[model samples]
Target: MYKSKIKNQKLKNNTYTIAVIGSHSALDVCRGAKDEGFKTLVIVEEGRDKTYADYFKSRGPSTSSGPTGCVDEVLYVDKFKDVLSVKIQNELKKRNCIFIPHRSFEVYVADYDAIEKDFKIPIFGNKFLLRSEERTEKVNQYDILKKAGIKYPKIFKLPKDIDRLVIVKVPEKARSFERAFFIADSHNSYKHESETLIKEGKITKRDLEICGKARGVWTKYMAQKRVFDTGLLSPTEQAELCQVVKNKVPDLEDLIQEYVDKYLY
Candidate 1:
C-alpha cells in the first residue's frame, strides 16, 4: 500500500495536485504547477524513456516513472480510470489533492470529466469545447474555399472513384512534395527509381507505400495546368509573350479574384 501525502508534513497535505496523462509535452505544465507549490504527477504509456522524470525532479518535486515519466510517483496502469480505484482514491482523499489530465489526449476527456464529477476535483481545461472548435475550423476552411469559388480538385470519398492512373492521399499527410506523385507519370517514374534503388537494396516497397500514404491527396497533371503566365519575367521577349497570353486569358483574372476573396476576406 502506498502512503498518501497526508503523512508528509512538507506537503502540508492540502497542496494543489495534478496528474498529466499521455504526452511528454505535459511535463511543462507539471513543472509550472510544482513551481506554484502543487503536487504534480505524470502518467504515460508504459516502456517510455524516463528522461522527463529526471528533468522534473531537478526542477521541483522528486520524479518517478508511471508510464511516460515526469511524475511524483510511478504506477503502471493501462486505463486512466484505474487511477481512480478505491486504493488510489483513498490516497487522493487523504492528501486533499485533485487530478488533472492533459489536454493532448482527447480520448481521455470523458473519463477525466467523470472522475472530476465523482471525486469533486476540478479537471483543468474544456477538452470537449476545444475539440469542437478544431473540427469546426477544418470544415470552415473547405466552406470558405467553396464560397470563394476557388478551383480545388474534386474530392473522392471512395476508392472506386479513383482512376487506375489517379493518385490517392490522406488529407493530414498531404503537406510535403516528397510524399506526392504525378500519378501515371509519377508512378512510372517511381517504379523506375524503385528498381534502381532495389538493386542497391536501399529502399523497400513499404517505404514507397509510406511515402505515398504521407502525401494523402493526389492531383492529375491536367488538373495542374496554368491557364496564363504572370508576364513579370526578365529578358524582354519572354515577358512580352507572357503579357500577351495574360491579356487573352480572362479566366486567369477570375482565378486570382477567387484567391483574394478566400485569403483576404
Candidate 2:
C-alpha cells in the first residue's frame, strides 16, 4: 500500500500527486511512486524530457510506454529552480501535488533557497536537511550521522598508516566527487592508490599531504564520507571495491580475491 505524505487536503481522486526530476535509471523514485498508485509528475531538464521519457518507455505497466510512459505527466523546464515559477504553481495546484525532491534535486533546490513558498501543497516527506555546498561552517552529512550514533567507516586525512577499511575520496568542499576506491591494507596498496588517484587527477599528492587549511583545526577532510557508488566502478576499479566489500566479510576470504583476480584485474 502507498502511504502518501500529501496531508490535509482530501483529493477525491484515486490519484495522489508526486513531483520528481527524472534521473537516468530503470528503477527509480518516479517508477516506484507511479507503481504505488501516485500520479507521478516529472520535472525534467529541457532536452532530457525525451531521454527520460524514452527510458521510462522501455519499462511501463499494462499499456507499454512513450509520451504516456510510466509517469502520469512530464513537465520540461529550463532549470529545477523554475519549479517555483507561476507555471509550475498552476500545475501543482491542479493536483494538490506532493513535491518529492530527490537528493540531487534537493541540492539544487537548497541552492535556490526554495521553501515550499505558499503553494499550499504538501511535501511528501520529512523536512530536507539542506546541505551547504559552502566549505566553511557547513554541516557535513557524516557528522550528522555520527551525532545520531550511526556506525560509519573511518575518515581521516591521508596518514602514515591507512585504515584497514579505507577509501580514497575527494575532500567534501570540492564537490567534484572524486571517485572512491578501497585503500588496500598493504602500504604498497595505499601508495598505489595514491598514484592512481593522482594520475586520474582526482586528487593531488599535496592534497594528501595537506588537507584543509593549516589552522591546526581538524576539517571535514577528517570527517566521515557519504556512501560511495560501487556500481560506478569499472572492471579495472572493481577489484578495489571487491576488496572493500570483502573486508566486511572475512569468511568469504580467498573466494572473493579469486573472483576479483579472474574478472576485475
TM-score, one value per model = 0.37, 0.57
Q: How well does candidate 1 score on lDDT at residue 71?
A: 48
Candidate 1, residue 114: Cα displacement in angstroms equals 5.3
Worst window of 10 by summed lDDT in candidate 1:
241-250
lDDT of 2 by residue, 172-217 (tens): 2245333233344545767776677778766676655544332211
List lDDT for all candidates, in order: 0.46, 0.53
Strongest candidate by lDDT: 2
- Cand. 1 Cα-lDDT: 0.46
Enumerate residue pairs that collide in model 2. none
After aligning candidate 1 to the native by TM-score, how far in Å is the CA of 231 from where it should be? 45
Looking at model 2, report the run of 10 residues with the lowest lDDT sum.
214-223
- Alpha-carbon deviation at 90 in model 1, angstroms: 4.5
Residue range 1-265, candidate 1, lDDT tens digits: 2255434643662266666663634666565555445666665446652644554443432466343323464434566555556665665555555555543444443353454445444456433333332212334334545788886555433333455434432212322212323233344543564556546555455545554443223433233334454333443334433221222212434546856986899
